[model samples]
Target chain A: MTKAVSSQPKTKRGIERRAKILAAAEQVIGEKGFAAASIADITRAADTASGTFYIYFSGKDVLFRELVEDMGRATRSQAAERIATAANRLEAERAGLEAYLIVVRDRPMQYRIVEEARFVDPDAYRTYYSEFGKAYADQLQQAAERGEISAGDAEVRAWALMGIAKTLGERFVLWEEGEVDIERVVAEAHQFICNGLAP
Target chain B: MTKAVSSQPKTKRGIERRAKILAAAEQVIGEKGFAAASIADITRAADTASGTFYIYFSGKDVLFRELVEDMGRATRSQAAERIATAANRLEAERAGLEAYLIVVRDRPMQYRIVEEARFVDPDAYRTYYSEFGKAYADQLQQAAERGEISAGDAEVRAWALMGIAKTLGERFVLWEEGEVDIERVVAEAHQFICNGLAP
Candidate 1:
């Protein structure tokens, strides 16, 4: 895993403090919620002083928004990489579905937090949804052009597919605690997306 | 619309109070969220006495639960009707999609509330998701057995299709307004479920 090097490179201590604060923020916000989570609680969780917290985050909301964005960006980047190598639409779609399953399965807490924050704050929701959504759509459009899917509307199809992958990932992979056949579920999702159930 | 007719009939005054309280509960909860919405604010919104609020609901959480159930039941009944009328598997699948789209578009606020409550309240989310999900799957199973879908797992197919429909309905129809063509979107959703996008 790459160390998240902050653009504003302060001292090594500063980077470590920010990472500590963000880790604490994810735990606090996920357990309680964005609305109820406070800077005091976050700092307490991180074992950092309140003053140190303000140095990294402007406020609780700002911290939570960054947390949401980071999670979203991470998930999309992973999915983008998995599908990036596919030569055709069907293969790309399959890779994309499998990638999503892997991402949500591996990082359930971070993923759920991103989704919950969607309703807790609309501004954050739009930023995350469109940013990730457009990237996901770009993959779909490439697949569509490869003659993998009968082309009509790439944007609509991409968003629609993103919704399906998201819902299924949340239900079967993220929310469920027990082991799931992720490969089977991914195949099922790919099949459902590529070919409707019609015989 | 039908008059207030529960299994046990209430006085006209009692019924009106219930309606007013429910309406107020929706607004307050929608704006303020489940945790922060207080009895006083809810009653104030309805113009009813705070004491009278308890006459209809045991408390705020109870009212919220009932509000969710009522919306779910209403939507489910409509979907059930549409699914029942279809003679073939394709028709059944198409009707089911149309039924969902109509209910979601017709009652977006209630739909959003139900979806949000699912994230906020786990038990309610499970109950509602399982019930409606099973209902949609049952319809899909009939179609699959009749050779509407390829010879694959019906349950997985059902959930996949439902996932697709749900993602489209919740994300596009309810969340993204004017971003998608309703008819085309519906057609594409059905295609993904029945034929998939694959050429």
Candidate 2:
């Protein structure tokens, strides 16, 4: 697809203004949806003039694509930091899952927006997951070779682990009505991840 | 959420007609997404007059909700049929995951529609997964009591398993570029389900 991020802010003030617009867009689009959410609404939420949006993003589609990419970058950075300190691949998996759920809890709007990308921006959505899946598979493969985790189809295992993390984040964090206990979720899920459903 | 599916077709001919409209609507909405797809587009796909659409459902919202429900029912029935013969919960999980991927392969459009429901009809989407998650946890709890599998937190395990099947279906069945080997996916994932990442 054509690069939707048409411009990049060069100065600190410009960067801050762009970040404000993106944050506003995430909340507006998350609540109202991609189709119903308007650029004016996003700008209004950002407390900026509507014309100012063009200085950062070329259009709504451009801005939406940026949000999808942003979720990937943000989640990866967060997960990577925690994963770095893990003792092994199994430990890394636990850390990564926890990091993912924490991100979902903090910036719930971003989570919703990324899910919306499946419809609004199909290519971006595919790239977001597949790219993450590829990188995740690479890590799992290296782990298996290092004898830190069981040897199996790393790609399949990676997607499965990613799935487990994604759904838990949705059910326990995003859609939860009462107080969330993410620690309990991580502990229980980590048990299953480390030791299957065997009796 | 105001009960968009207004009426149920009574006569056989009416049932047939309504079925035609729904099948067409699934295709149209899957291709163009929920908001961009219009009643006219659905009717044209059905090879019927635009007004004929109103006979079955109230509006696009109702039809979209029905499509989301349809995926859940179809998947559950298919899975139940397979799971009934499985010797234990682990076997049942394998059967269920296989059934899910097969459905994704066969009715890809329906899969897209249900995913779209996350944004198009949030309540229905929540109900769809939560209901399934609850029932799945029930089965896991029962199996745990029977000494068929090790269990820690049934609810957390249920959502995590659902996540694995959902993502695997998306990547292997829905988004695959080459010939689909669903049997391999089922086998590989079932291995992980019965035995996690431990070496």
Kindly list the interface RMSD, in angstroms, of each predicted candidate in the order they appear.
Answer: 2.1, 0.7
CAPRI classification of candidate 1: medium
For candidate 2, write residues A47-158 as lDDT tens digits: 9999999988878998999889988888889989998899998888888889999999999998999888888788999999999999999999998999998889989998
Model 1: per-residue Cα lDDT over A1-199, one tens digit each: 5432224338998898889888888888887777677888889999999888767665676677787888766666776898689777788778877877787777666676776775776778777877766876776677667666786666667676777777678667866667777888777777777776677
- Candidate 1 structure quality by residue, lDDT tens digits, B28-75: 876677777899999999998999876666667678877788777766
**Highest TM-score model number:** 2
In candidate 1, position A162 carries an lDDT of: 72
Backbone clash tally (model 2): 1
What C-alpha RMSD separates each model from the true structure? Answer: 5.2, 1.8
| CA deviation > 4 Å runs, candidate 2 | A1-5, B1-5
The lDDT of model 2 is 0.91
Candidate 2 lDDT over residue span B1-199, tens digit each: 4655558888998898899999998899998988889999999999999998888888888889899999999899999999999999989999999999989999999989988888788889999999999999999999999999996799999999999999999999889999899999999999999999999
What DockQ was computed for model 1? 0.55
